[model samples]
Target: MQRAITAIYRTRDVAHLVRDELERLGLARHHITVIHKDVRTADPNAADTSGTVDPADGIVPAVGTAGGAYVGAGMVPGAYMGAMPGYGLGMPAYSEADLVYADAFDALHDLHLPEEDTRTYQQAIRNGDYVVSVEVDEDADIARIQEVMRRPEDVHDLTELDKTYRDAVYAPRRRPPREGYRDGMMGRRADLQNSPTTRDYIREEPLWPKGGTA
Candidate 1:
């Protein structure tokens, strides 16, 4: 598995490039994951022409007529502000404006957060914008292989998720995202809590041992 945190390639055609690279590296197609990068902007004219973005120097400012306006983000300004120590003998520590437009640009371009799940800046992130885009588990071929024992992962010892990672890293609850909505403090949504599916599945899993002869 290629576990290194390497972009290896940056392009609008990231999905295609990733598939090609995995084949070149002689890895099974099922093992590759392409971290996509998508840009959101209201102005079409100002979007970069070449589709080339330099991570270090790219300007993520919402520079429009007067002040930049970001779509899908309700962050006009003054939403988030923090202090910054001024660089002078007696000067006071200046503060960072709650500039949502500026922050989005920096997060996507500067931090190379083209597509990640959690945002380092939230209110900046509207409650419903596609920030990070991860492809749904496109490992169907791998799953099929495993079912036939060509690959074996289903019957291993109980391997629970990491406590810290699951409890905290996963936003709503210890459950997976597709599990459904969760309530305050991250409990399962009431409708699904003690669901019949859960109750039935636990008692009816395909876990019986086969009869054997010596």
Candidate 2:
């Protein structure tokens, strides 16, 4: 049976280094995954060659504008200000942070961890930590994987880290230009609530050439 072993790092750099080390130890890149926030900024000088506005950027504002106009005209109810599109209901759209949380949750869920443990792991990611998980088919490789991942100085034991940050709160520093409506509609949107099954943000493909198992 394949089993997953995971570790948390305080920074993405260290987590990535550890992942490289794991690959060096003969684990297939596909057998390991990293879950973290998408912090990359788009280059301003980069031409919009695609000439496409991201839906996340475009749709939310349109919804808010239409909703506001209708509400002001007394045609639509005020309660539906931030309702998400395409659901045929007034569900709020998820923020980028929420999507990251969902991605982290889905990645952890693949391990079949207990619900509480999964939440704790997800919270770790939300707290600006990076998660590196490895799936090993051989029981003998578990110890080696753990050793490699935990060698970093800033690595933390999940439960202990949870206790340290349990009372702390996280607020995203940046928001998309038109996210005001979404934020006003729903702030923080239920804290790690969404459990999207798709691994939209995972890195599972083999990064190294095919090789024999460790």
Q: Highest lDDT: which candidate?
A: 2
Best by TM-score: 2
In candidate 2, residue 13 scores what lDDT? 74
Lowest-lDDT window of 10 residues in candidate 2? 61-70
What are the clashing pairs of model 1? 62-68, 80-98, 86-93
Candidate 1 per-residue lDDT over residues 1-214, each given as its tens digit:
1011112222334334434444454443323223222332233334433233222222222211111223233432232221123312332221233232333433333222212222321222322121221111222233222222211211111112112122321111111111121221121112221211110001111111122100
RMSD of each: 17.8, 13.8
> How well does model 1 score by local distance difference test?
0.24
For residue 61, give model 2's deviation from the true position in Å: 28
lDDT of 1 at 206: 12
**The CA-based lDDT of model 2 is what?**
0.44
Instruction: Give TM-scores for every candidate, taking all chains together and pairing residue i with residue i.
Output: 0.21, 0.49
Regions of candidate 1 where Cα sits further than 4 Å from its true position: 1-9, 19-38, 41-75, 79-133, 137-139, 142-214
